[model samples]
Target: MAESDDASDSILPEPIRSVTPLTGPHPDAEMDVIGWGIFLGLMLLLVPLLPFIIVVWLISKLVEALTPS
Candidate 1:
């Protein structure tokens, strides 16, 4: 038992363990404010534009109906 203990201690000079987890992208990653702004702005624009888009589509359909196939 003593010899086994000595062998194990000699085999590893220092304890090989990590106190903190390996640094990963999730921990180091940063948010992109410009990207967020662009996407948010586009979403805001889309909400207002959606009604106009539908109205234009309806008008186009009406025009199409007035014309021959």
Candidate 2:
């Protein structure tokens, strides 16, 4: 089992070594833009609603506490 594990580890690095490193704008650039866009969009949409959401959550918690479960 230990020998098999060592063989597998050696083989794994072979594939990694064969792969050419990417050159150019990072492959994640587009994803970064999309992720940031989603984050900013959510912030814009949620910021105004935050107070209302908090108020509703507080009311629910208050009611839950006051009511006999």
Candidate 3:
């Protein structure tokens, strides 16, 4: 038992652990502001692109429908 205990202690010099988790948003106001800004920018950019995409898709469908098969 004593030899086994010494061998285990020698194999590991110290216990490895973390006191805190390394995930999730930081509890900071700046990070929240940046996140909201990025979200809003994405929404604004996508909103304009969506209608143009829809218009182009509708025009293609209209052309396909009008074409004689």
Which candidate ranks first by lDDT, i.e. highest? 3
TM-score of each: 0.46, 0.60, 0.42
Q: Model 3, 1-69: lDDT tens per residue?
A: 999999987895676889987897558898889999999999999998998999999999999999999
Of 1 and 3, the candidate ahead on TM-score is 1
lDDT of 2 by residue, 1-69 (tens): 999999987774434454677788557788889999999999999999999999999999999999997
Superior by TM-score: candidate 1 or candidate 2: 2
- The lDDT of each candidate is 0.85, 0.90, 0.92
Candidate 1 segments exceeding 4 Å error:
1-31
Q: Global lDDT for candidate 1?
A: 0.85
RMSD (CA, Å), candidate 3 to true, equals 7.8
TM-score for candidate 1, residues paired by index: 0.46
Error of 3 at 28 (Å): 1.9
The TM-score, computed over Cα atoms with residue i paired to residue i, of candidate 3 is: 0.42
Clashing pairs in 2: none
